[model samples]
Target: MKMKRKWTPSTRFMLIILYFEFIKETITVPCPASLHTANDVKRCPRNKLEWNARAARLNCSSINQTCVDPSLFEYHCVLNKEGNQLLEVCAPSKHIHEQKCTEFNSFGKLIQASVINCSDALITCPDAYRSTEMYKYQACYDVVYQSTRNEEAHCSSRSTEGKSHLGIAVGLNGEVKCCSGYKWSNRTRLCEKCTPGYTGPECAYSCIYPYYGEDCFKECDCQINLCDHQLGCTPVYWFNNCPHQPEYEEPAFTNTWKQRRDFR
Candidate 1:
């Protein structure tokens, strides 16, 4: 018997006509060179011919050749994405020239100048470029010239003495002493001593008393002997020549009268 078949809602269906419409609409649009040429002037005889015919007649060999005569076209020009001429001409390369002027600290010394051209620019060194103070400038067609200055060396002063900080000297004991100035005191490092009348750490002040005169050369004023009588007397001198006077002055008898007769 012919039974009734069930139709499920999940069953898929194909639409060939609709798929073809979507594919055609999604394709990329091609450039219309024919329409582009119509907007240009027809004055040139070369423009009237096809690009391939013009290239063959010109005998162009390079693959990078864009046209029969590149000179006729701007060597440097700006164009839009659709191959339409936006700007007539622009800089071929975006580069500029930079110059540096250098001189030595001394005017007689020689100085060097370095220049670097990164773009289509003209660079030149000034007369002062070789001088102690150099002035360099860079220029372009329409741009202003920029100047740079520097210095070089000519004459300089150098120390002839070595790096040692000590001075040699013969000590009183015949030993070598590292002295700096008048004083032979410093045993380690070189240092200056007190001047004719000065003393102290830096020999800055004048000396007093025994240490008097220039560099404390005067003798001290202190007494030499504690006792009044002495052989070596400095300011004053005295003599005591009583040799037997000590024994005569002995206190043996208290009162000496007629001795009360030896009657005892």
Candidate 2:
């Protein structure tokens, strides 16, 4: 049999480096032209295209003409998945707020947008609905390019902060605390589903009384205005006066162990 190759510390380090390099390539690489859907989009064209035949057909000029020209590099049309509306906004590759507007069909609009550096992307749910996922966007600094002899070091960033829990802190500046309605889960590393009796962004607001559970779907069967978010209904004993248990007191110290045993 051939000898088994042993892994050295240097070899392991090199492997890790290669793995990261591969991921970087994956993220930086442009999405295939054929892949048009915005579902979990990750990459965009590195350079602006001279002309977009697609834009001529889209005819977004009346609403926002900038939606089509790929040469703009930062402009891309965000097609509403539920509707036909297209929203044109500035979201650079490094500043992309992923998973925020998954409901909207990105329509391959992964090109960077024109926005101030390190800006937050706010995404709110529609009326009568609260989001269990999607949090306020926060940008974190990352080295875009390492220093070289001729060029100085440069940095890039992304608006997608860790954890989708609302109102959580971004980056290393402070503790990552989930909102009241949300609990941080170590396994998923994201704020999970709504907790009992709580819903809304960062768990800031509670479900109306008599309605509890996620999105206030569960109805309470208890008395009026007595329902709890998690427990459903308030206990009847809480309103009634119950007999109090007599306080226990030790018997007078017995003169001897036998006396104490007899008293017991």
Candidate 3:
């Protein structure tokens, strides 16, 4: 005789599959080419035949035409998974960009990283990437690279002394330079002060308390007497606070067993 098997509600629920639902519909959704209903767009030819065909067709590569995607590297894609194909995601089609990584903070930094296409996004780089900052300090920096997610984010170093947010320090000649004394902070997107003991504003300022003067690096001298920072330490003349005041002379005291007991 065959024994009848019973199915539990949990077991039955697990075996059931929802009908009419496309598993990949959410993930395989085709991303638009340029993010506009009808932005300047032309399907980039994926094959060698279509390589520069778009530019050639539009006559953008005629030297006289000012086309941004002459090489068709800045093109975007749309996909169709019905059978098999490529254009579902939107990103830079740059085929020849140097691979270099830079670190950024969660404060919305527009950092750059070496990407073999944009598939290798540096957004999740826990380490192995850092902006042109000397030290992470309080935080990294926030740089506004692209205005939208589809755009490329650029590295920027704004001086902590000036705009401490969403920008980097641009030298007088428009070059990236870390503000002196101010180490670049990845978290705050501003040049933050050095380690503890540093003075001046919040970031990169005079050295520390003990060390004063230029960059707060020069230390004061204590000399023979105890170093009373405010009183006689460095260049300031050594002046005793209690000069020749009354001298406390204790009278001779006789040790007694009764006095010892009383003191205790």
Q: What C-alpha lDDT values do all the predictions have?
A: 0.27, 0.37, 0.31
Provide the lDDT at 12 for model 2.
98
Q: For model 2, how does the per-residue alpha-carbon lDDT over 21-88 read when each residue is reduced to its tens digit? A: 66743343333331332222111112222112223323223332232344332323332343222333
For 64-175, candidate 3 gives per-residue lDDT tens digits of 2122334422322222211112121222232122322222111221122322122245433233322222022111111111211112123244454565443333444556
Ranking by TM-score: 2, 3, 1
TM-score (all chains, Cα) for each model: 0.14, 0.22, 0.19
- The digit string of per-residue lDDT tens for model 1 on 1-264 reads 999976554432234656765553332122121122221111111121222222333322322333323332211111222221111121111111133322111121111222322144354533322211111232311121111010001111211132343334434454443332233343533434445555432443333223344445553333323111111223232224322222235343533433444533
Position 120, candidate 3: lDDT: 41
Q: Which is the leading candidate under TM-score?
A: 2
Candidates 1 and 2 compared: the better one by TM-score is: 2
Q: What C-alpha lDDT, on a 0 to 100 scale, does residue 215 get in candidate 3? A: 43
Pairs that collide in candidate 2 are 90-113, 91-113, 92-112, 92-113
Angstrom error of the Cα, residue 237, model 2: value is: 8.5
* Regions more than 4 Å wrong, model 3: 1-169, 196-210, 217-264
